[model samples]
Target chain A: MTETEQRAGTRPIRVLIGKPGLDGHDRGAKIVARALRDAGMEVIYTGLHQTPEEIVEAALQEDVDVVGLSILSGAHLTLVPAVIDLLQAQNMGDVVVVVGGIIPEEDAEELKKLGVKAVFGPGTETDEIVRFTRASVGRA
Target chain B: MSLGQEILRGDRRALARALTLVESDPHAADDIIAEVYPHTGHGIVVGVTGAPGVGKSTLVDRLAGQFLARGRKVGILAVDPSSPFTGGALLGDRVRMEGRGSDVFMRSLATRGHLGGLARATPRAIQLLQAFGKDLILLETVGAGQSEVDIMGFADTTIVVVVPGLGDDVQAFKAGILEIGDIFVVNKSDRPGADQTMRELRQMLHLGPQRTWLPPVLSAQAQQEIGVAEIADAILRHSEVRLTDPEQRQRRMQEAERLVRDALADQLVRGVVSRSQADGRWNEVLAEVAERRLDPAGAARALHLEQD
Candidate 1:
């Protein structure tokens, strides 16, 4: 029997990894998505160029345990807050939100102040991100 | 308000949570489903299946758009396979879907190592959508193989998509898939050998025993939305026949009976195994079987006898 079949009758954690704005570089996003999937989390990848509204809409509809935003467009301040606001406004304040991609240290702190769960900058280990996500969603 | 009541009242978040509960904690979902069961059977459920890269998701996207244009509230359940090693899944169907809007509800499901090209909770998810007042529910299966025919039990209409150059007419003779399709679509028909593919599908479909509904073999380039309207029309036609056909009631009842029997068998096995394990009899029997003191059949019989 497969590993999953051995644990039949249980559900795995679900995550949505999305890239918002006009950023077309999805290599980082795809890498993280694969890492999460390999770690046993179902990851919904909403490819590039998504608006904040679209990201939150997908998060709500999918009812994911975590929303991992991979933003490299340098628009994290505007887009991240927009997504968080939409999510909270839509009554999804409990969904854990994480950010990845290129972000300065100061902005990362700023995002945490805005309720972003964690910010993953360049050279961050995928395993570290995975572990952090699991703990954030209470699955670790 | 109760979650079931909220779902019935058309609260999107409530419905989403209920669906998550259905997938994650089915035991908890039982009460909710019982509460909403009477309101189900109102929505039309369509199942789309095919081999990998056959454009099942793309076609579903187009079909959802068609239904939306017709003013229908649509719910989509897209199933992908979970990794056998880690149980994780990359459900990327929404990437190809541009038709989802405020009125369209889409959720991705991992098969979670369950076979038959669908997640275990798919039927319950469909029930929830029906209770939420969706006019149509689209179920897109993980790339189906020849024997993944479970979708037949749940969907009102089943569309099997295929692309050319996969195989020839002999491939269609493979029993299970051909038997379950209510409609066959040759997606990516713009590619070479399209006519041959369609002709083979039509011929194979004809070879089946004649029934109330003759499954139509249609061609489509699903990416550009070509022939999608005709596919919608075919689904409508099939639905109409099913609604009016006298035998459909008997078919549905038979399906229900099968589902109940399967569930009962599952519960019986689980209950017996858990009880045996708790009492140490299961491990005792396992050791006996491992040492060759008792054969597997004898151990199984002993377990069953112990249950009494």
Candidate 2:
């Protein structure tokens, strides 16, 4: 049997990497996707300029355990809430949403209060992201 | 209502959830299909494929839009490859398509770790769409490759897109794509060498084979809406060709063969893995092979892997 036909040896955790709004910056998303994969997670990346609806649809279709949003467009406050609302509408509010990118330190706490599991800002290492996903997804 | 009933009743949200079940969990998908199978087989399915950077997404966007213009509900199943190494994938084809609408149901799928998933989950997704009342389905796959070829087996008509300037011709395509394409489209035909590319395709068609159905070489500038109507006409014309009884039988046989092969392979792996703990030596045998102490073929024989 091909590697794909057989399930992964461990049912590797699945993560959806999303870019919301018109930001168009995917360098961080791609890097985080690579990092998460290196940590043995199956990552589904929805390419840049995705709407909140598209991101939520992808998360549902992929059956991802975590939804990681990369927002550098200063639109996180709007974009993140949109995703959260849709995920809840889809009965997936508990799907562990995480955010990464340029965020004001003050907005980070607001995001967490809005149910973002965690946030990674500038100068954050991929390893830290990987560790966070492992522990968070593993528990969630 | 049950998922199957919802799907048969043309519930869009139910159909989406059913497709998700199929893409992620084969066991659950099987149950859903068992209930909905009889209601499927209504939609005309088309496979659109080509190398990346060929504007395939744009062409399909136009193709599906035209079908919508004709009032047919369209379901687009776009497959993007996942990195075999990290199991990470970027599925973005739908980004270029005209945004969602009431009559259109579009889903972008990542290959998830299945060898031929481009073909496997696709038929099931198509069936859900068919059951959900889509009159036409477009199965879009990533560029030319073995998986793309394997995935073509599920379609009623296959449209292979080739752009002019990226540099490859009929001879290059002849390696394999020429045989499978029901319609060869020169997308981005507004670019230089559009006519030259079309002529090369025609000349190559003349030399390829003698058959009742001659796959047409058409030009399309999808972004500008140039020649899309002709390309659509060719696709519709090709799909209209009736299959001879013998040809019909052959097609069914091929589909059955592939289905059986995939099922058997899946079952074989499941059985062996499930029985390994009871067998006691499964890991030891694997270790022996991994260490090269026993060849894989010999180890398999020892395990009676082929006795069935």
Candidate 3:
């Protein structure tokens, strides 16, 4: 494993990178997934146009330490909260939720209020996201 | 309720948690599994294995749908390889599978440095699924090449998937997959060389020793959902035959023997290694071996397994 992918006891940190809602653009999500994998994390990339229910179900099934939602379709206000609520309703509030893709400062703040751990807008370096992911999850 | 109780009550989240525990904390997992062991042995595990790009995942997805339609609760465990260098893995098998509704639980596993085309925790995960009361469990192994036959020990029905145009009839024999498969699927059979591939596979099967149930070489275009039902039927027939067939009983005995041996081996090594480390003998012996003052076998002998 890479130096960054330290295990809490055993098994690498598992992350679910999901694209919720009608966001067709997935380049950012793919790049972040690749960066996480290179850092020795197991990344489960749920391909594009996933519903919030689908994303949360995947999180529950995967038991991922983190859920990174990428939304470029300006539906973060709707899709992000839906995912957060489903996770929380399932007693998965400890699963760190992060938002990426085209989210504005104000909306990002609003999402953080809704329990998103962090937000990365466009042009945020994948390394920054990777470091933040490593820091946010208990496994790391 | 206890974790095992929750799992037996049909809680999906608890099943997920127990599966994670299987990978991260074996001691705790052992306790939970002991509680639920009696609830298991009901799930039929089907192992789908093939070389890379041979449509194993899609075929599994299709077969799961078939079983689900037949009113069976389905679970899927798809394994991909981890990077030997970094230990990281990008698990993409789920992408190939369309959503199979909520009752069909799917999990992606990375073979974290384990060999034989599966993760070390796979059997444990399968047990968790079984305890959660899934009627069918489909195991998709890492794109297996030659000699990754460990699936035979874990699967009730082993389906060896292949595509056309790879090689002649001898290819399957060379890979040693010919012997382990209970049923063979020539997936993506819409391609030009599908007929020749199926013919070659049948020819090879006939050349081998006969059994109570001859492994059927079937055809399928898993992507389009064509011919998948036939393969599913074949799987069901094999599962039925596996119950009373003397040959299958012998195979099951062999599998149980291997599982026992593997568990004993793991426990012995872990016990001795941990004791040696606590007494500082492990590091000393390793250092000696590294410096070539003591050979590797001699170092192992120094551990004195008989006394430990």
DockQ winner among the candidates? 1
Higher-lDDT candidate among 1 and 2?
A: 1
Please report how far candidate 3 places residue B112 from its true position, in Å: 0.5
Candidate 2 retains true contacts at a fraction of 0.19
* Ranked candidates (TM-score, high to low): 3, 1, 2
Task: For residues A1-140, write the lDDT of model 3, one tens digit per residue.
Answer: 21322342477888999998875888888999999999889999989878899899999999999999999999899999999999989999999999988988899999999999999998898888878988887555
Estimate the TM-score of every prediction.
0.95, 0.84, 0.95
Q: Which stretches of candidate 2 lie over 4 Å from their true place?
A: A1-14, A22-24, A37-44, A47-49, A61-63, B9-21, B101-103, B112-120, B145-147, B168-171, B243-246, B284-308
Ranking the candidates on DockQ from highest down gives 1, 3, 2
Residue range B1-308, candidate 3, lDDT tens digits: 89999999999999999988887656668888889988887758999998899999899988888888999999999999898877788998877877764779998988887899998888889989998889799999999767789898899999999898876546655647988899999888888898988888888888889888899999999999999899889988998998877676687678778867977887787677778877888888888999999999988888866345
- By DockQ thresholds, what CAPRI class is model 2? acceptable
Q: Across residues A1-140, which tens digit of lDDT does each residue of candidate 1 receive?
A: 22333466566788999989988999999999999999988999998888888888899888998999988889999999999999999989999999998999999999999999999998999999999988888873
Q: lDDT scores for all predictions?
A: 0.88, 0.78, 0.86
Q: Which 10 consecutive positions of candidate 2 chain B have the poorest summed lDDT?
A: B143-152
Residue B153 lDDT, candidate 2, scale 0-100: 77
How much of the true A–B contact set does each candidate keep? 0.76, 0.19, 0.69
- Over B90-142, each residue of candidate 2 has an lDDT whose tens digit, in order, gives 56675577655445777777676556537347878887888888878888887
